[model samples]
Target: LVTVNLTANTDLNSAEEFEQLVIRESGGAVVRLKDVADVVLGAEDYDSEVRFSGQKAVFMGIWVLPNANALDVLSGVRTELEEINRDLPAGLEGGIGYDSTVYIRDSIDEVLKTLAETLLIVVAVIFLFMGSLRAVVVPIAAIPLSIIGAFFLMQMAGFTVNLLTLLAIVLCVGIVVDDAIVMVENIERHLSEGMKPFDAAIKGARELVGPVISMTITLAVVYAPIGFQGGLTGALFREFAFTLAGAVLVSGIVALTVSPVMCAKMLKPGMEDHGFARLVNRGFSRLRDIYGRALDAVLAARPAAYFVWAVIALLCIPMFRMSPSELAPSEDQGIIFGIVDAPANATVEETARYAEAANDIFFSEPETDFSFQLTQPSSGFSGMRLKPWSERERTPNEILPGLAAKLDRIAGISVRAVTPPSLPGGGNFPVEFIIASTAEPEQILEIARTLQQKAAASGMFAFPPIIDTKIDQPEAEFLIDRDMVASLGLNLRQVGEDISAMVGGNYVNRFNIGGRSYKVIPQIQRAGRLNPDQLESIYVTGPDGRLMPLGAVATMKQSAQPRSLNRFQQLNAVKLSGVAIRPL
Candidate 1:
């Protein structure tokens, strides 16, 4: 088969050029594609729309790889955004409207601020408790050393500096301080007891060495199980547990190795003879007397202690059983998502109006900083980014119920406000129960409805379960008569293609605008195809190039059918989704 190429140009960059596409040529009467169809460029799906703060908008999201750092990835994206925004055309703007990393950054900043304030408070408290600058210095040295060592341990464990790990660091401040302060007070006590600085230091260090080791081991043992346990709990808290355990171990080491040495060098005879030291000493002695008396009284009634301990132990099981349990406690991520359920047959415009109502409900809360909405023909979603955590006292979870109440008042649309998943991988809804079987879709749907009703009756869900595999969408089927089509000398393929061209919204070819290739989809005007009656006006090619109305070859059948055919693992599936009133 030999072929000769006449024109090298295959890229039709405009509708005018595509309209000149050759269809047929006979007796010098060439028929172009424009004669049979209209070529226009438009959005891929007219049913999907997005808005930011009530304006048409497009969004782009940047995600970090699992092994990569989120902060670093967002840092790079933010830098790139600056350049992109600088080059945007007039009357247009581009920037990050939403960033999950902002909450993380703010959380980290808040933790650091608290850490600084705590350190200052720790210094003052230690001075007042000991009435000795020497004691304060020893702890100041030991605390940082322990924390830095904990950071080293984190590095060895390949743990990132995250919320949980930082929280461990903060908690270590108290644990490490206890070990350091105990060692300091022991050496200081020796100094006041008339022991020489060097001898007191050695004796104090040796005396408490066993106690320090025991304390460190006890602390480490408490967190060790948490680090090694199975499941999401272990994964989330492994770094936290290990970091805290490491910090305690490091604090123990520092207390024995550094605190004693510093105490020997810094402490001197008559150090506690000062007036302030005597006053503080007197107050502690009286407090110690009161504690000693209380202890003696408790010991005098020995059976009471045993009875109290027995009662406490017996209460543990019931208390634990009755406690509210959730995957994780709700957190303030500064955003709330409003899920919008539109009628199955609602148009995109109708969905948009529903979404606007949802957005209004979201913004009705004074804490809302900004709002966004997205809509499709059958569903919609909206979100409100609350003010910064510092500005808003209530977390997103706290505000969700109120917003949901307001949203419930909107007629027709069902809007459910939800906080971001407390834990990762929870998906959009709390309850995503799926019913799958090899049975027919109708059977699966019936089973699903039964389950959904049961779930609603249990009073566990915030709303009635919404089944996904609903057979309620109205459809108009074009029932073609193959016999009539054949007798009319009409090609079945041409007939189907002609009908598809008129209303299918399928792309035929690509046209370029600037350097971008756009799809050329030829569909009847929206006004002309608004109902089933409009389908009759569409024409198809017949014998001898005659144009025949589609109504002559096909009949319209109105029926209710499933909006979609859903399968899971090759089994018919129906998903019932809802929010749980109680935590799962």
Candidate 2:
């Protein structure tokens, strides 16, 4: 037997000491660890990797704080990026990998376009129906005035103009015009009854005050429930609901206060003698006569009318019960979100390979503008930003099923393709159920597997549900032989320490350089420890300080272990999450 003496404790402070470590001394010409492997200092693991626009790039996610404006935050990020781009080192650069705010800005532009179109349409419709520029002008003036008042109320309530509030403003155009139109028509009627324009305006406003108040109350109440709703609905719609209600209330007040004066100034005696007015008045007269006769017939059949009204009222319940419900409707946000789930034993590099396969599928689509990815050891999230809505013939919703099918075909991985949520704080998957128990996590994992298998058999999901927690990580255990170790004149402690030092990747201590501390770790290079079979070649110091193969006294046994264990509510819990094939 050969003996190698340990004289003093050695502290490896740099790569050179680790490289010069002695694995064994076979002859007068010594053998060293460097003969079989290389030593290097680097990160413990490359767990976080990002790919942007199909190129290797870094990714950073920015989340908005509560009560903060997302657009403003995005703007600041963009400005900072410009400065960062300027200072970037040669041939290296940084910028936004993907911005969710792109969709928000695009949607805002579409809503603004719709707002302008609605304004033009409103003006055209009023001109066609009333057949008087003067009548159209009066109501058109009220539209802007009421909107101004609504803006004031919104400011007072600490509301900002957003997508939903902009939509409320678009809708308010019609409601504000409604009050003005009513005032104009009623005044014209009084004028035709042989009153002066000034007298008719005053009389019409006084007579319709009650009707206008009731109209305002009814329209305002329609959106009151949405604003008062308890959770997500209320939070999302409070601005929309109150904006609309406040606009209508302002329109009513404006009509009672300002529209009557404008009507008097713009009206004249027998304005119906002008364009389309005479024909419209004639048509209305005939329709009114017919309506009078129909009313008399309905009064004669009061019993049947009562029965018909009651039947219609009862039909609402069944219609409502049969309707499908969901938290929010699907929208084409111009991007597709994807989730990559690899085997529990998979490494970062393995998962990245799977992610690449999925990314190719995403990038292959005709509408794809760019693709981005964030990778982890066993799971990741990725996405593709599509071209503009006007540019793409198919929306993200239309393309999702086929894309998902293609992603599922990738070997050795599960890829889920979905559209991003239209609203904040919404679930990414359509189906999610939590299973909690006081039993051990292993027990809960078994129960979760059964549920997932049953769910897959039922064909409810686009694919089988994925459990959040898994007990499937691979492990390597050395089955040390106590008798053999004793026969070799070695104890288990020496063998264990030798194995741990060589492959455990534990840091021995720290060394300082350039005012910063770096961990000093000594381990067999990655190439030497690539697989469990290589562990047999590792040498440990025996009781007499002679080097011997670890295989002589210990054997490695392969097994599986839990990837993670989590506790929820003081109980082990597992979540089953999936995107359903059909809306549930």
Candidate 3:
């Protein structure tokens, strides 16, 4: 059993910590993480693509674990925050956000408050124009019926009640009541002139219906273009278009159908006069009086007005140039990552150990939450996984860099660095280029060295610890004399078993405790696998039933070679990777 305890200064991300916790609980029986690999502390390798309000921030997505309920986990996370908030680190605060569904449900209460406020505003506007109880009540009735009807339509059209939709509702404060205003004002004027209430209402509504319907249709058409934009922009604004269009249409219908009926019921001959009504009437009379005066002055100064208009138009042209175009506004969600590689021929166990140490660095610093995952290259003569993948830690910023440095110490691993991920619709970094060549490794190395020098002198990248090229490996030989083995009545297969047993170690059955199982690996006693002298000193059974020394059948020699090599177009190549401080 391998035990890993994280301590301060261990800088690690949430992903790495999650990975380590998984390793500790699994007990290596289902699979020995170590047998497969090592663990260590390192820097944040992945870049955070998004930023919030110009400050660098990353998203740490949280999902309910299997067999766990979302709301329950959400509650737990909230509790964790309360605990953390009691003593938060400087410059940081924790907040939670939900998906669209939950957001709408929570915001619906606020929408009701807005709805009430809108009603109050519409009442004030009506009192300003028409000045009586009959006038104020008519337009106010149109607001709720229009909105409720809009809500039903939005539901049918699959729209969520969100910011844009709510904005559309707010916009309706002026628009939806206009038709009601026109109908009510016309009928009241007829009543003042001594017409019967019912007759005045019918005549007024008939006179205004054409213009009201035309205006509503025109406004709806103006917003129709938004629905066709497509993708993210269209998806966001579609609800606004839908709700606003529905509200206006409903308001128009109510003006024609319901307003006339209500006016007939409410209007009466010689109704009681009130002080507020007189004030409203006097205000409109003054407005018309002022407008007549302004009209005469504007006509006399038409040339000056035109000159001012031209100047304003010229000023607006320059202002347009200052506006910025972007895909979307950025948001902050704190997150971090740790990337590292291990030494050649290093066992999985060692790799996991290295990762755990890195995780310790993160937990110690108490950065954001973190998690990690590990993958390995396939077994082969090339000593490279066709994938050449890795294990990574997802953590908060406080622990990321320190964690990355810890992983860099592992064997066979190189080119470890921390970087933020690319932005949406933007190119991502850490992209590797496998430059293949027919030239020898020496030549490849030389070319790599030159490229590195050019890159360094160019001042194009600001990140430190840049490595231009990496050699695959040092070469070695395993000599087996088939003839000598056959003469002794021995087989090559047996020799392979002896070597495999001596090195790879055989796996027996498993042992279980607390419902968890671990694999039992049996290894032959060996002085050292890397020492040729020790290989010669080992013993194996021969065909003659006599123990034969390994030295009698083979010779060992050293040579330079790559543990892993990649090719492009049948040419030998090595990959060069590094973080660019400024995005290219």
* Highest-TM-score candidate: 1
All candidates: TM-score: 0.91, 0.87, 0.51
1-584: candidate 2 lDDT, tens digit per residue: 99998687565667777678887665677777677766666776567678987688877788899889988999999999889989998998877756778888888998999989989999999888888888889999988998999999999999998899999999999888888889999999999899988899999999999999999999999987799998888999999999999999999999898989988888998899866888877877899999999999999999999999999999999998988776677788888888888887777888888788888898789999889999898788898889988888999878988898899889967878877667765454667788889888888888999999999998867778978897778888999999998887878888888999898878877865456688766787667788888999888887688788888888889988877777778788888888665556
lDDT tens string, model 3, 116-153?
Answer: 78778778867766667766788888887888888888
Model 1 Cα displacement at 372 (Å)?
1.3
The residue-by-residue lDDT of candidate 1 on 1-584, one tens digit each, is 99987877778878788789998999999899889777666578788888887788997657789889889999999898889889999988766667888988988998988888888888889889888776679988988999999999999989999989999988888779888889888888888898998999999999999999999999999987899987888889999999999999999999999999998898778877786877888899999999999999999999999999999999999999998887776678888887777777889998888788777777778999888777888888777988987787887767877777788898967887777766785455666888888899999888888998898899888778888887878899999999998998877899989998888989897767899877777788788898888898788888898888898999999999998889889888889888776765
Q: lDDT score, residue 218, model 1?
A: 99
Per-candidate clash tally: 0, 0, 71
Ten contiguous residues with the weakest lDDT in model 2: 420-429
